[model samples]
Target: MPGNPALTEATYYILLSLHKPRHGYGIMQQTEELSGGRVRLAAGTLYGALNTLCDKGWIVLKTVDEDNRRKEYQLTDKGREILINEVKRLKELARNGEMILGEEL
Candidate 1:
């Protein structure tokens, strides 16, 4: 099991993108769209993160296209749990910030 330490922005988005099965390019596009273009994953970075996520059992290979040499990945149950937890953590952070800042800062 991976620890609950904060996920890097890239890793977080990568996991989010895998909620539906997607190929590397699809993941890249979806991630950029999801982040409003704030995050653009390069090929090497995307593949590396995909490998890591697979090693962690957070994402799994959903399908492979032998003709086109493309692969699609989707989130595992554990991956969804992790993502949900991350959302909860983010919400808590936002709530605390709003409470403290109070439109002043």
Candidate 2:
């Protein structure tokens, strides 16, 4: 799968939150918790990110409630690949930063 170099921080967390299936609100809560409350995504921002991820084939609708009000999404195989690649890239970045700063992080 071709990787997206332009994936934003919000996009990364949003995708990561879907490692299991989750609805929009669930995603928001998990993202905040993951970031220690430093990355709270508003509903609109999250919905927009979800739409973009869906269009990119990175996430898919996994389930819907009987009332059709809650929909859960999960990562596709391609999404997992992308997430792994992003992790690698982030590690490289951290390594480089540590090297330049002369400190371990």
Candidate 3:
């Protein structure tokens, strides 16, 4: 949907974050925390990913109640599927790579 999202770890993290219905900054913080600082979603990148996922029908803006400043997002069924597929792909790649490398050494 988002043009070979198959190669994006950040995308997966973003999707995972929205699985719990979180705001933009909340999503960013959660994603970073979950990845142990290995991943940081910048404002630009986060919005871009959100829009892309929305266009692909994977995610949607659940609600917006900008008090001081905030908006939340939630994952659609399609989003869950996308995330699941990405995880499976990652596992397969890891298995294959590990086997080949271990055998060679």
Candidate 4:
């Protein structure tokens, strides 16, 4: 565990998108697809989040293609652990809610 707080929906999706190496546009598209089109990341937002994640050591620049001007990023091992923890936390939240509502979770 990284002792991280709960992840925002955008951060969660962004981290999830980096399960494989992907460039900025690929990340954006994959995030939207993963969220069922509910999370369309603007260019500024995407880049900003990418930089922040990089700073946090959750993701790293995996490759840079100078000719095509592409930079690909991938999750660090720490990032994977964070993602897994987030999944567990989310499941616990849903389970608690379902218990209160007396519904299957």
Runs in model 2 lying further than 4 Å from the true structure: 1-6
Q: State the TM-score for model 4.
A: 0.89
Estimate, for each residue in 15-72, the C-alpha lDDT of model 3 and write its tens digit. Answer: 9988799988898899899999999989998889889888989888865665755667
Sort by TM-score, top down from the best: 1, 4, 2, 3
TM-score of 3: 0.83
For this target, which candidate reaches the highest lDDT against the unseen true structure? 4
lDDT of 1 by residue, 1-105 (tens): 574678888889988998888989999999999999989999999889899999999999865878877779999999999898998888888899999998886
Pairs that collide, model 2: none
Give residue 73's lDDT in candidate 3 (0 to 100). Answer: 86
Q: What's the CA error at residue 11 for candidate 4, in Å?
A: 0.7
Candidate closer to the true structure by lDDT (higher is better), 1 or 3: 1
| Candidate 4 lDDT tens digits, 1-105 | 555589988889989999988999998999999988999988998899999999999999966778877789999999999999999999998888988987544
Q: Please, what is the TM-score per model?
A: 0.91, 0.88, 0.83, 0.89
| Candidate 3, residue 84: lDDT | 83
RMSD of each: 2.0, 2.3, 3.0, 2.2
Q: How many steric clashes between backbone atoms does each model show?
A: 0, 0, 0, 0
Candidate 2 lDDT by residue in tens digits, 52-85: 8899899998667767767899999999998988
lDDT, model 2, position 99: 92
